[model samples]
Each structure stands twice: as structure tokens, then as C-alpha cells.
Target: MVSLICTLQDHRDDVNWCAFSPTLLATCSADKTVRIYNTQDFSEVPYSPLSGHGYGVHCCCFSACGQYLASCSTDGSTVVWSTDTGEIEAVLEHPGRNPVRVCAFSPDSSHLVSGASDGTLGLWDFRTKTLHRTGAVNDTTMVACSFTPCGQMFVTGSTYGDLRLWDLDMNQLHAEKNTHDLGVTCCCFGPKILSGSGTVQFRLASCGQDSTLKIWTVSRSNTGSCKMQLLHTLTGQSAPVLSCAFSADGQLLVSGSVDKTVTVYDASQGTLLYTLNQHERYVTACAFSPSTPLFATGSMDKTVNIWRVEDGHSGHVETATFSCEGRKLLCHSRLLVSDWSEEDVGAWLCEEGLQALVENFKANNIDGAELISLTKETLASELNIESVGLRSKVLRKVEELKAGCVCTGVPDEYLCPITRELMKDPVIAADGYSYEREAIESWIATKNRSSPMTNLPLQTTLLTPNRTLKMAIGRWRTSQ
Candidate 1:
């Protein structure tokens, strides 16, 4: 369900990090630069090529409000810049060649927290433009940092297999069990959940050098101590998992790995859905666009790959095998008119006309969203379909699909066994099961002489109308 959108090649060196605002994207690179690009155009901002960092920028993050951008680098400093003007507003200098490994903006955009390799941690206030606190997380190298949605607390992780939370200047251990056996590389907060009784819970996802991703459910206790419970541990990457990003809705998660692949999973079930392997080198970062079904991945290959997630309920059929190469189409879609007879097409478009309409829009290079917002007349006109009869049939089919169904409360036994939908024209098949005429015909065409539900051998291919079932269905329809 992943389709390539476009490829961005602007960084002269390895792109180490990427972040997304509501409508813009900012990337940091080993080229000693940070560039912000409009999501609309995917072009660098006019004043971008921001090159204040004396060394490679290792990480970049956007404030919750999308008004500011923050970056950390091996130059031993962190800079906060205005996203609109591309101006550096604050500079906090440290004392090392070691990269400031991790940084994140507070939920309120009022503060930024950063950590350096040697356990050096600092919290800076945006208003004062000064480092308000400097400390260390024990004696371990901090690799990951994130703030909760409410901005009341922030979390930090170490290369030493530990996770800690900061609350009003007090650091508290949130997980009794270590997240991974090795160093934690990245951690991001998942979507928030509010229970029926008003209890709040947040999901935290982390990946590490152990080559595993772990999800932890966390909550605040009455005494204000964060309580943690292990939810699930996902393991598939052959190499260390480098980064993970959660969709804004918290239903999906994408993790990058040193195995040179990006794995997408259902966040709630930990079910692996897709594995993207376009990057030649290790995938360094992953970011989900907040306002669209889009995500961008950056790697050591220095190219940013954009992808779109498809949301159709995929049928167990090979739809198409065409790529954007040589303008060739070798498709096998069941719904295409070229592949199906006119009667079959009519039958299919009758039951599932909405989906077929979308498929037509796709094939005709029409905007599918227009089908939703445009009136039937306007849509039909916009399609500019060559065959007037075909256009009328399609538009009439759409109206029938949209018109409210009058029939309801039909007996399940009178329904089509093959389609699981209420029968329009019931028929008796050789297998002796009642089904919609079109449904059983389709089943026989696809499955030969076998029963759809039982797979039993069929004695004949002929079908007869079920007069009894038809009468009952007719009465039900009339009553409704």
C-alpha cells in the first residue's frame, strides 16, 4: 500500500535528520546545512541553505506550534530559528566536538531540551533565549528525547538501556524494565487516550541498538510519579532500529533501521504492514506529514523519498502491474472495462458503483476528490467521457448507489451466501445454495466448479431462479 510520490535530492551529503510541520518540511544534513521546504512545492525556502553550524547537523525538530525550528550538530551548539523568516533567534553553545545527539521542542513551544553525547543535558527557555538548566542524566550518553502532548513532562533515553522522565526539574524513572537490551536510538510519544472515567494514558514507542521496537503504556499516578507497563515488543529488523515516527492519529508507526529498510506497522496491533527498501544505505530518519497520508524518509544516500499510503480494502486479486516507465500499462484489474465484458461491468458497477467510479477517475486522470464534492452533472461533465451512453450509465449507476435503500430487516437465510449481502435476484445453483445470480456467476467464473464456501465439487454449471426466495424478497422490499 506504499506508492512512491517523489524524490528530493538537494543535500550534498548524507541527510541525517528530517522533520515536518503542518505544511512544510525541514531537513538537516552532514553538508553543514539545514533547509526548509514548503510542503506544497517541495522547494527550498528562499533564505534557506541555513549554514550557521560549523559541523554536520545531526538532528532537527519542529516546535509543536510549527513556528520555530531547532537543530543540533557536532559543532557543540544548538540553534533555534524562526521557521517563517529563516532567522536564527537563539544560540546555546556547549564545549565539545561530540554531537549534541538529541533535541526536542516542548509542547508549548516555550522551551527546547537538548542532550549531548557525554550525558550533558540542557533545557533552554524560548522567551529569555538562554539556557535555564544544565545537568547530566547519570553518566550515560543520551540518545533520545521527547515531550508529551500536554507539555507537563518530557522523557529522555540513554545508550545504557534506560528511560527517564523530567517533571518540573525532577527526573523520575518511568519504566521499571529496560526498553531494550542495548542503546535506545529514538523515542517518540504515541497518541493520547482518555478513558471513560477520565483517566489519561499515553503510548511511548522506542527503538534501539537491540534491533527491536518496544511500545510502553504510561500514566501519571496520584503521587505524580509516572507509571509504566510494557505493552508489546516488535522484532523483525536484521540490523539495529534507528528511528520511529507515529502518525498524528497514533494509529500507524514507521520505523527505520540500519538494515536499509523502513517498516510500517499498525500501532495498536504491532502488525507489520509494509517494508520500504529504496534506500541504499542505512535509513537515518522518518517523518509523517501531519495533514496528509504522506511520509518522508531520509537516509545516508542523501535522497529524500516521499510515499503515499493507499487506503482501499484490497481484494484478493492482482489489480495492476504498471509503473511510471515508458508509458506502458499491463494491468489485470477486475473492475476495468477492458478486462471485463460489458454485462459483467454493468453488474459490478451496479453493486459497487462508488468504488468503480473512483477507479474510472484514476484511469481517466480525473481528480477523484471531485467525485465527492461535485454534483453528478458537474462530475459527468468534468470527466469528458467520449462515450455519451457509457457516461450516462455510469452516472445513473452512481445515483442508484447513492439513493437510500428502501429494503431492510430481511432474513439472513434469504440472503446471498456467496456475497453476504441481501439478495436482489436469488437463484439456485448446482451446489444447491441460494445466492444472488451475479454473485454465484462471479464465483463460478473465478473458482471453476467449486463451491465458494464449502469447495465441494459441482455436478452442473447451470443455475435456476429461486421463486420462493424471490417472492419473500419481493414482499420484504414492498413492505419497506
Candidate 2:
């Protein structure tokens, strides 16, 4: 289920684009400003209403590390700002001094690309703040740009209704003509790289004035040849689709349309999931949070609406008593086994259909911590269990608990500063702190250049995997 969470009405003009970092949301508008908000409470940041652009801002995006924000404008410049302080870091003028329509940062945050009204594209080296190259298509406005997960290539959509793929060297790799009957409005590459049988594949979603959203599979074979194939054409929204984005996991797709509606789909299956009708005017922009089950949509009415996707089990009708009880026990399974009390252990055994063992567990005063450590020897000797098969079943259930439990007592140090979630793939950042690899990478790509904990400038954007911490977390999980 999806429900509206909040509506932000701070923008004074048409909202042009919306973007999200791990912990923040950014929206640009025709009022010539960019606003930043804390995702935790949906509160505006202290230095928000960023006014660097001389003309209406057209697009905005965060650097991978969440250190910087980039916004383009009709002023013919793409400005990069320090997300920490909301100060302009650099101003990159487009080659032809044309109105900049869209800007995106590469996955590694090493490059920033800005597309212009005259079809000119500027590729900038983010670290050195220099223009690395320039390329363009003829006679059409460049409106959309997105880099592939591998960072070796990117896709661009233009007013001419064409989608073109280009390598980092500014060479055109492939082009699909008439992708949208009228004009292509936006395009985004999924966050994952799928590889099998000597071919690397990517998913791309593009929406257009044709009033449809198209999913395409772009693949590169071992021989270096590339191909693009249409996978699905979504028609949930009746009016022209203006913007589209993929969830961080690439499992869901969302689009905003001129019909004053927002549509979300199961991207993998090409099935409509929900249609939202909250905006009073044309919906122009939409974005999904990289680390949470939340999405934001912006409209020409100058409002931004935040919506949340709830777990499927929520709000479902219980068909049977056993099913309701099973659902309740499943919720409890999220608690760390180490923190479970004796009663919790007893309840767990009942839920596991080992009701005969409940009294045995309670008689010996076994709790969650002890339950996780149980083995065949303990079941036979300490718990006084006689049946070998029963003991093995109990041990197997305990093992499953250790592997699946997502408990609340995770050590603070083991949580990513950006997402505030327990780190699965921990990595040490240049800030000398550990974070989930994907979280920090998303932070670096889209937020400020400072340490999330220290509020001090980060010296570099490099991150090193914390394998030791990863192993420690694994051990802790097993112990729980």
C-alpha cells in the first residue's frame, strides 16, 4: 500500500525536479531556487532555498557521497554547491552558453555532465573542476541524462524523441530513434548491473510526451557490441509522462505525468501497482529515496508530495486464526534473538510448531541468547531431550533464527551514518568512519562533501571496504 506522508509547499513556482540523498530531499523550481529538507522529519534545512542560479533552475542532483549538489539553469551554467554549507563550490558554464536543462553525477562522483538547450553536453571532471569534453546532437534540446551503474557509459534523451548511448570518451555507442512519439522527457538507468553468459545488461526507463513509459534492456556482449531492446511499455498514466525513476534496488519504477497523477509499477514484471491522485496540477518530477521505502513527487502547482510504500503484509485481511497468529509471530521474528526473553523463546517455539519443546525450554529457563547457542549436545544433555530427530529439528530452527533475525540492538558503530541502518557491506570512508558501502556511495554521489558525523570536509571521496568489520557483524549476527 502507498499513502501520502506530507506535502511541501515552499516552492513559489512550478517545481521542475526532485532528488533525494540518503537522508535529505532536494527540489528545484522555476522560482530560481533549490530547497533542501531533512528526510527524517521532512523539515527544511537551515540554509535551504539555495539561490545560486540567475535563472530558473531546471534540474538538480546530489554527488554520490552526499557532499555536493548540482543544479542547472537557463543562466547557461551548472553550479555545484557544498551540501554541508549550501555554498557554491563551482560554476561550470556550458560550451555554447545555452540554457542548461539537466545535470547528473557519475556513479563514482568523479564526473558531472550537464546537457544544454542547444543539445550541447558538458562533461566535467568533478575533482579538478574542469571541463573534460563536450558533445552534442543537432537541432534538438538535450533534456535528460543518466549514467550507467558501471560508470563507463551514459544515456541521453532529447527533444527529438531519440535516446542515445555514449561512452565516457564522448563517443556515440548506440541510438534508438523515435523512442517517444513526441519528445523524450526523462530517462534513468537502473542501479544494478546484470551479467550472465558473457553479456552485461542494464535496465533503462524512459518516459516521454508520448504519454507512455518504456523499459529497455541495454546489453554489451563480450565482443564489445551493444544492443538495445524494448522490454515493456507502461500505459498506466494517460497524459504525457514527464519524469521517471527506479527505486534503489531497481525493483520498482515510478513516473509523474501531465495528467496530474503519479504511477508506480513493479518494474521487473511490468505490472501496475498503484496510481496516486493528489496533485492539483501537472506532476512534473518524481524521485525515490535510495535507502528507504519512500518517494517524492513534484507538481506544477508548486507542491511536493512525499509518499511511503508499506510492507505487503500490512492492512491485509486475516483469513484464519492461525494465519493471524503466524503474522504476529513473524513480526516478532524481527527482534534480535539475543534480546528475547524466556517468554519470547517460548512463543517462538510455539510459532515454529515445536510446542512440545516450549515447556522444556521454559523449565530450563532458556532465553533468546541461549536459544541461539543451542546444539545437539545441549538438547540431549542440558535440556534432557531424548529424541535425536526432535533435537535436530530444534537446532535447525535456531540456526534459521540466527540467519534471518533483523534485530533492534545493533551497535551504533556498525550503523551507516547516512542511512542509520546496520551495515551489511561496511566500508571506511575518507572521513575515518565506517558506513554501508552502498549508503556511503549514494551519499557521496548526492550530498555534501563533508563527514556526516564530523560535519568537517572530507579530504577525498575514496572508500575502502571494512572486511574486518563485516566479519565481526557476521559473527554478531550468528551469536544473536
Number of the top TM-score candidate: 2
Candidate 2 TM-score over all chains jointly: 0.66
Pull out the clashing pairs in model 1. none
TM-score of each: 0.64, 0.66
For candidate 1, the per-residue lDDT at 301 reads: 71
Those runs of model 2 whose alpha carbons end farther than 4 Å from true positions after fitting are 313-480
**What are the RMSD figures for all models against the true structure?**
23.9, 19.0
Candidate 1 wrongly placed segments (more than 4 Å): 95-98, 173-177, 193-199, 313-480
- Each model's lDDT: 0.71, 0.84
- Native-to-model Cα distance after best TM-score fit, residue 209 in candidate 2, in Å: 0.6
